[model samples]
Target chain A: MPSLKTLIPAIAASVLLAGTATAGDLVSYKVVDYGIPSSLTGKAGDAAAGEKTFVNRKLGNCLACHQVTKLSAHPFHGEIGPSLDGVAERYEEPQLRLQVVNAKEINPDTIMPAFYRTEGLHRVLKNFKGKPVLTAEQVEDVVAYLKTLK
Target chain B: MKTNWNRITLIAAACAVCVGVFATSANATDWGPYQVDDRRSGYTYMTDESRAMQVDSFQNPGMIWVEQGADLWNETNGKAGKSCASCHGDATESMKGVAARYPVYDEKAKKLQNVETRINTCLEKNMQAEPYKWESKEMLSMTTFINNQSLGMPVDVKIDGAAAEWYEKGKAFYYERRGQLDMACKHCHEDNAGGIIRANTLSQGQANGFPTYRLKWQKVGSLHRRFRGCNKQVRSAPFGNGSDEYLALELYVKWRGRGLPVETPAVRN
Candidate 1:
């Protein structure tokens, strides 16, 4: 077993991390730097699960505003945003993740919604306050799926 | 003539200074001709098949509401035993060009009032009847009846002096973002006028076809009724029909369709 001196620091570190989550104030999200994070919550996301989220209208619904020609069955994909068929070849993984997390950080007027940010939004219902449109895990999953588009 | 143009420019520039113009207001005030009189029937982005139905008077579904309106126009309903026809003789003559100048500034009321208000005023004062509820079928029938007389006439609402303040308010309202969707009216109607969102193709959202027939509702509806529907789509709470906000919006959008012909009982998706 670990000694008391070592256990004290370990317990404090876990408590600090736990407090960051628990749906804290959305203002805290400003700490999410403009560029990429070193890792996506330190989890290895399943690509298969991420692909399902990409196509589901209730989830990511990216297909609503973009055309991904790779999905043969999805018809009449929107032409508003550019096609994302070979996006992985055009952008690095970190850049793609930034755009997915919050495109408005780059272009303030882009109609593309911020899928994983939790600040400066209107009418986020009571139960959903401080909650990003998708959870942190979902964001990681989507990023993994997007990296496969090449 | 040069002096008249200069005077108008002075008024417009003054308006800009007073109101602090919004960015989306420019798009609301400046748009080229929307394709009308063709298959699209003013809503240029809707399907050609829907447009075909609007042009064919016999097959036009809105004609049913027009026919219903015609019946209500001549019927007696108030406590005074008076009908719209009792004082205003033949509608074909008395109501000509009336709908074209609607949402006028009422001097006594000190506010902007549209055709719906005018109809209700007559309903209560002239006929001594209870005022019709907003968006009610009876109100729609009367409004459609009166406006149908001005069919094919170009929209020519006069927006000068007192009307100018309301017009600016309407423009501001058009560009203001609301609801969880955070969408301004100009985004869908003005910016993406020809773009497809989901199954429907967006149009310039002109009000010339109001008291329009929408297949979605399978009924004739007022412009304010459509306003409520649009607000709900954006997840915003809509105010009461004929509310000041909606009336101001009506005036502004009417100016947007300035030269377009009125197509009351206009068929829409």
Candidate 2:
């Protein structure tokens, strides 16, 4: 057995190595299939309605962190997150949907809430009551609009 | 009418100043959150005996956590034939001034470490004990005991040198949008501070006084638990309890409130 002094360094090193390895491949994973479903498909989500979801303080409230096109009339935009101008080009419709519905399904260590998963996480809202905040159809609509971001 | 308008404008300006002064006055109370008195001066103020009692501490649920911590401090654990006391020798003296400087950049680990992470390191190696799961009661209690030693001291997280990189990383974590709500820490704490969200008033959300007792949580919680709570408030997914991102954010927030007193068991509205 390693001495206590030596063991700590070893454990710390392994943890650091694991973190770095995961960080390098951050972008390659698929987000939607794990649990999140596409919000855009079939009847197609209305971009206008989706836009409302992006800014509605009580509902989607996306503007609280991200900066989108201000010309569209959404106010009180924040710079904490990222600019959403060209997101559509970076991800497919299904991927976009998955991120919206549940980013953690892709990254367990994420800070994104699962808008779609209704049950069985340790510290989620009881209002979700074992149901996702948004329906599969609603997710499709949001995904459709998000895909147009580029 | 022009004269009346000028008078109204003057009155409005005076009102703004008065409100500002009043807000600053509340910050001056030394007994309040973060050990900041009415002037926002960061000076910790609690008698040693008062510090020992959970009820006499800040009105938050963290008092309960501190109580639990006190118990754990004396309890024996692992193969070491020791409690934390066996090695530290009276934490009130040995551990003083320790809490204020943490989330230090470890050259060996090449990562930031807060008090809890460091304690787990001790348990795993020094004590030959199994590490407590992150956010476990055992971990929280031990951390609270250690930090209580530093009560009334100003937080002193050094942000220069290699620690600077960790600070920046923590800042990015605070600002990044990830979960469904896509909200950052600045949204609720900075931009919307003093505003009403649902029923809760958005505080400036400083982390100077943590291991705090929040009425909303009805329990003593770590800063990372609060981070998780904030993520949930925005409808975003939360990071795991002890993830590096959360630790980095904790480091940054501690640094941001650097001069503030350690309000380990502070009460929050």
Candidate 3:
């Protein structure tokens, strides 16, 4: 498996090849460089509460394909995805927020569903029309918990 | 000598009884959940009345696309000024049993072709019109309209000959790991089937009743889209729409649900 460091150059090359107009692109690299407010800055959140949110189906549901320790009661924890052992050390809080909110923004071809950007992306359930799967507050909480991984 | 003969006869009778018991247990085991018994027919939750209701409610946003397909069938396009109806006639009659045999090996192309690809080919070659983009609303509608005509037929994706290669490719892809997260399809669908993934019970991830009306989606969608969704959930970089990997996986899924009746628009949670 290629490390994220190795994959970044290839991803950058592909982005260049796709001819994306960075000026209008929200959360684009240009915007990141231009010092737009990153999605990560917020009040500190409880990791214990966030841990509950991670395993809760109504919330994060992170254990579906990921194996996370300290949450063993949740059945059907999948091993298809990697174990989240040292994720905080790999990515900063803002990058983590971007990934959780919408991974495709970073990689246009990502399979990871946009937890925050529900509009125009998700096939809306009739009852939950216009509602995101995760709210901004919940994302912040999860991000807070993730930052403590190290 | 007579006592010895009597004892041998008793032992033979006991052996026969044991064989009968074993056969009965085996038959019972075959009917249990997760056993893909050839003798038993596939089961579904939708009833005849419910299915009729769903069909009648074609006014739904999802079915609106199908209605567009109904119009497209008769409308003329391309320089030839010929409509799809010109050759296929009434789709209800012409397209019956067509969906069941799809994703078949195309001898000319020397590859597997699904219903959508074949339809595009017909549009380009026969009608002389531009082909619809794969996974476009127009294409989905057209394909759904055609597939709806073949409801109740058994799925018959051929797995022999050159088509076998595609099936194997699909199987390998399903088991292979990828993405930053590094997971495979079987880790959930097979290994943890019926187990709880948070609140929802993990289905075997069968694709027999596709273009299903999912509670989460609140609309009917194709199996390919579902495959894409699963990959996304696992944090893998997704294959592009209509990519060969997705197509191969679709073929494998269809084969997995072989012998199950085509549920063109099933409701699922």
Leading candidate by DockQ: 1
Worst lDDT run of 10 residues, candidate 1 chain B, spans B31-40
Off by over 4 Å in 3: A1-150, B1-65
Error of 3 at B218 (Å): 3.4
Q: What does the interface RMSD come to for each candidate?
A: 3.1, 7.5, 9.4
TM-score of chain B of each: 0.83, 0.77, 0.77
Write the residue-wise lDDT of candidate 1 on B1-269 in tens digits: 35798889999999887676554553452213343332123455556687688768898888887778789889998899988899998998998787778889989779898998988888888899999898787888778888889987878887898989999999998987655445678877776676666556677788989899898988889999898888766556676898888889999999887777787878899
True contacts kept of 3: 0.07
- List model 3 lDDT by residue over B33-148, tens digit each: 22354322222233445445454646333466567778888989887789889988999899888888788888987777887778888889888999998667777778778877
Docking class of 3: incorrect
How do these models rank on lDDT, best leading?
1, 3, 2
Give per-model TM-scores.
Answer: 0.78, 0.56, 0.57
Q: Tally clashing residue pairs in candidate 2.
A: 24
Clashing pairs for model 3 are A80-B183, A111-B232
Alpha carbon lDDT at B147, candidate 3: 79
By the DockQ metric, which is better: model 1 or model 3?
1
Model 2, chain A: how large is the TM-score? 0.64
Q: What share of the true interface contacts does each candidate keep?
A: 0.14, 0.06, 0.07
